[model samples]
Target: MTRKAAEPSRRQPGPRRDKEPLHCIAACGREVDIGTCVIRWDQPGSLVCPNPRGRSACTRHDPRLNDAPTLPFSRYRIHNPDQAYEELKKTVHQFVLHYDVCWTSRHCHQLLADSPFKGSHFYLDLDGTVYQTCDLYWKTNTAPADDGLGNERAVHVEMANLSWQARAEESGLHLLQTDAYRKTDAGWLLNLPAGRRQELRLQSFQPLAARAYGDRGYFSRKINGRTVRMWDFTEAQYAALIRLCRGVHELLPRVRLQVPWDPEQRRTPLDRLPGFSRFEGILGHAHVQGGNKNKGIKRKYDPGSAFDWGRLRRALSR
Candidate 1:
């Protein structure tokens, strides 16, 4: 089953998308249905994931792929659904979450597309439009947890959120003169520049964080030995994410509808997991990586402090 996506909010979008959901992703001549609105690599105006090193069982972070031609989605190298599904099921066990630290999914994709090798399997936009850059049969170089073998067992989603960058003092990569979110009569709206307004599927969309903490309209907490302060994800993102999680679980059972919960703490832990590499569920990048320079894994903290892990847990439970 699939949910046919409604039209973009304003002017017609380019590279035309399937007005009707194909309900499946194409790869190696096989397609698996995922019941959601996903802009695929084959779609017009797609922000395609780059550098397919190889299939699920054959990936190993090949530098050579940086220069390799990204094959069309319709012509993925694998040609057998049974073999592809079996390999994917065994290889992918965790769904890794991230806050893209960008204004929208298009911005996030621009950064990835410019990089020699960085890419994500999915991008959850501010308006909750999910962009599937490539087939789930391939591995993306999004998060390489402590064991350095994380890519082998995880698929990734780069949800749009500036994270700590929402604040001027904490902003780094995408420096901001002031806070990225502005408080309005309506709510705490992200100050998306007018120039980038068209990036969203909903031109009139107000990118408000679903929840906020106190007067500042952002959440401040410690995660992975550092202070992270940011606004919550949008309500639309939460709803779409839950649906996406359900679809992912249906398609790949091992990547269960669960997050990193600390039973004693009575909430999800916002730090690297001790059994990080062994866990089998949806989790934030912070849950698996506490940067070790010697080990070559930079510290990661994403799907940050403002993310509602408990809310996600409750929603998934149903």
Candidate 2:
């Protein structure tokens, strides 16, 4: 039996195991077979690995692995973060460029040429109070205060607002409001015929400018530098738009609608409306009424704000 000292058996350096999906264990430096690993230890020290009960290593080598499986996202995850970031960055850069450098409405037009979102949000708060209202509107109507043009264009806008809200509904945009306002003692006063509370309806997206008074429309928003023609209906169009907005609202419930905050004022009547949560964003029209001391109105866009290069991206992608 001693003839030719029996050759010694070679030992493997790492953990011994059959071929399997490779996963670095948290405790051992040695690679253990996936089908065999049974022990759980924190850092890879000489802790016991259960599979063979012999495998062991230190924490330095193998880190914990995330076991979560991959799954598809739902429509609620509609806004692509990566893509939205790109758009936000581009719009922000352009805004910086034209912010003070290009001091004209036309300058703003060129600045927002690549905006991802249609409009910028503006907040209006009454003085001496927390009350605020926010509205999201595309930057149209950027002409120099209409040059005191005929009819001042407010009545035309009023008609347009009524029509546009109806159209937006038909086109599948559901505006939502919050019920929190109803529970307040000030809620009953909201029953007024012409208070801001009445404007709370998602339908009243636009409102008459202070100077224009009772003439402007809710949806008659301004854009870069021109009167962007809304989906003005011929009665037939308005009816169709109503149905569409309701349908779209039903389909995409996440696109919530709500009142904008008015930090300066202590009270906000718009908060009392129903279904305010459906609105996704806001429209800034504080300047539309001539209160913008900075004259931001000069920087607005036209009705066809979509004609700009920025919106073209979305339209083209679709």
Candidate 3:
């Protein structure tokens, strides 16, 4: 069961009122003083004064208006991939990866824009080009409530593509179409190949790349009274991912190569952990989805059973 990406919110631009002086357009309903307020356009075509007083502003309007000194990776990295890489080297402790599981890059961007969740530092398009959306060093709202790992400390990467079910049908991959597993108390535990699991574990780097689903779980859609978990990353995607990981490792030598999941234990080590700020490595969303002691369960499987970990490992090794 695959779900279509939500259409981007299209709000009609408010009429420009030049006669009125600029005020704080936020819901706070405060009149901004030009002498102290920092004026900027937060939403499209909406000029707003984020700071009404001389004090700090709210993040709901702009995330960058905080009092903290700017780090090297503070700027958006969309067009400057090299600069983004260099900046991330100085401060990034963890590199998290996620599949857009949506349609096009435009759709992915729109989804992120409308979502309450903060966008990832970089986005990998189907053509293998990596685009930066946010600062690598900035903490994001990707983590669950009170889970601790978020934009403040981790770097996130999103890969734009379709979900596993749609991709499998289009590509004629029968293995992914099989319904061999059942939903359990823990979640939908997938019976993936051991060889593939080993491959994923081996390719992981330190601190692990956290999957977005780790905290919130997998997004599922029901079809014909059956629940389906979808995730399909292409071979080209894997190649690009390997290159990205290698580049990250070259810059941050202290980062380890390891998955956060404990295959023997069949669970994530960070599930109940207080925070991920001190830990450094690469982990997937699946490793963090169930939460500590499986307290807050959302998704059970992601990067799904068909993700080609062996191929990724082989490519990285070469």
Candidate 4:
């Protein structure tokens, strides 16, 4: 899906009409107050989704011939913001998270823009800035899940993390000759290119893993029948993500600020869930897209082994 940028408003970027333009998550073309900073699609410093997909089947909210998943904003029609928001909240219930396998959110945005039809509603940066690329009313073809209906009911965030690709041995995609993170005195820190360092939203920030596994500074575990290893998210990322979760919960009441948990296993299962679509709340893309035992679809491992599910769960509990 390809998304045309939002039509430029005659008014300048500052102080958009109706929206407070600060610390909010957008829905139905308007901003709803959220916990952290969110750069909206219409704002000047926004990473607008290159291709925004419109689901034609959902006529309750929009019925303007919006079957095209790659329709430009101008082609899509929204009759009423009040009605569309209510319908959108009723229809959407899941908040799917992803590791973008990029060095930074800016880098992730560039890759998304280069892609033919790939897009996400939000992008969580290493420095803790959340970029809202498109309104939650639109669907991004980020994950089809197993039933191929995950995108239909969920909003998605592409957080910047290299995943297994950080290690040269495990990184087949990028062909990295060395590990992305350097063993600094402070612990493990993602080493970005000199030029790219200046691109971060937080100029003084250093992307360091909030926690380390053993002495390796990364964690390895079996997820989706495969060994997935990655460094923990930065303290800032986890903090920002928690706020984002709360913010999502605020905007879409059905999307609770909680992760998946198994009472029998006594741990959060890091694999494709059996009743994925039915389970509502915050979840990883891996939880939705990790194909079955028979292997009809390719397995997915992301928001990988290193993510702190327990911390997220504990925070959401409060």
lDDT of 4 by residue, 135-233 (tens): 778788788788877788999999989999999899998788999987788989998777777778787789999899878889999988899889878
Give per-residue CA lDDT, model 3, range 145-236, as digits (tens).
23533344355556654445343443343345653232445443333344323322122211111222443233444322234445444444
Q: Number of clashes in model 3?
A: 33
**Tens digit of per-residue lDDT, candidate 2, span 1-318:** 011112211223666465532222211112212121112222221121111100011111111210112111111121233332223222210010001111112222233333322111111111100100110001111122312211111110101121121233332332313211111221111111234333232223322211211222222334333333232112321222222222212222222222234457632222111222122322112112222345443333222111122221222223
Q: Which model scores highest in lDDT?
A: 4
Winner on lDDT between 2 and 3 is: 3
Task: Estimate, for each residue in 54-90, the C-alpha lDDT of model 1 and write its tens digit.
Answer: 5436433243342346654444444555566667777
What are the Cα lDDT values of the candidates? Answer: 0.78, 0.20, 0.41, 0.80
**Which runs of model 4 end up more than 4 angstroms from their true locations?**
1-21, 60-69, 292-297
TM-score, per-candidate, Cα-based: 0.87, 0.17, 0.47, 0.88
Q: Quote the lDDT for 42 in model 3.
A: 42
Candidates' RMSD to native: 5.6, 27.1, 17.5, 5.8
Candidate numbers, best lDDT first, in rank order: 4, 1, 3, 2
Displacement of residue 134 (Cα, Å) in model 2 is 32
The 10 consecutive residues of candidate 2 with the worst lDDT sum are: 128-137
lDDT for 229 (candidate 4): 85
Worst 10 residues of 1 by lDDT: 4-13
- Model 2 off-target regions past 4 Å? 1-232, 257-318
